[model samples]
Target: MKVKIDLEKCYKAGECYYNHPELFKMGEDGFPVVLHEEISDESLIKHANEAIEVCPAVAISLED
Candidate 1:
């Protein structure tokens, strides 16, 4: 699975970071930054999905 974050749509709310700190990072400007392009591990996929779900701006997406 591949995780993609639409930077333009992100509000920099930091929910993704709170959910998956290892997979997501916050930029200095406060936008969500994807740490990895692809998430193949099952455990990590769950966290990535949680990040997507928790994003208030609906900026995160998963592509499989």
Candidate 2:
């Protein structure tokens, strides 16, 4: 699976990076950047799901 963020729908809320620092980080422009685009780890998947739920803009998703 891969993590995909739709910047057009993202509001730069920082929820993903703040809650899951291991999987995401704040970019220089203040947007969240995915540390791992392709995820095979169960723990990372959990974090990604958590990020998706917490994102106010609903810009985060997982793709096969």
Candidate 3:
């Protein structure tokens, strides 16, 4: 699975990082930065889902 975030739709709200600090990091610019493009950890699916659900800008996406 892979995760993608739309910068145009994102507002840098930091929800993704808040939900999954181990996976998402706050970039110097304050946006949620993906540690990796590919999601291999099955345990993190729920966290990713939470991030998508809580994102105010609705920018987070998952691809299988």
Candidate 4:
């Protein structure tokens, strides 16, 4: 699965990047940035899911 973010739906809540720095980061424009586009690591995938769950804007998703 790959991590994808809908910038239009994002509210910059910082939950994704703050809690899962290994999978996400704060972008230059203050948006959440996906650090790893493709999630093949099992541990990382768990982190990704956590980020998705905590995103207030529901902007994060997984793409196959």
My TM-score estimates for the predictions, one after another, are: 0.88, 0.95, 0.87, 0.93
The candidate that wins on lDDT is: 2
Question: Which tens-of-lDDT digit does each residue in 1-64 have in candidate 4?
Answer: 9999999999898998888889888999999888875879899888888888888999999888
Off by over 4 Å in 3: none
Q: Which ten residues in a row have the lowest lDDT in candidate 1?
A: 11-20
| Superposed model 2: Cα runs more than 4 Å off | none
Cα lDDT tens digits for candidate 1, 1-64: 8889898898778889877889988888888778987879999988887887778888889998
Tell me each candidate's RMSD, in Å, in order: 1.1, 0.7, 1.1, 0.8
Q: State the lDDT of candidate 3 residue by residue for 1-64, as single tens digits.
A: 7778899999888888977897799999988788877887877777788888989999998899
Output the TM-score of candidate 3: 0.87
lDDT of 2 by residue, 1-64 (tens): 9999999999899989988999899999888899985999998998899999999999999988
**Model 4 misplacement above 4 A:** none
lDDT of 1 at 26: 80
C-alpha lDDT of all candidate models, in order: 0.85, 0.91, 0.84, 0.88
Ranking by TM-score: 2, 4, 1, 3
Cα lDDT of model 3 overall?
0.84
Worst 10 residues of 3 by lDDT: 40-49
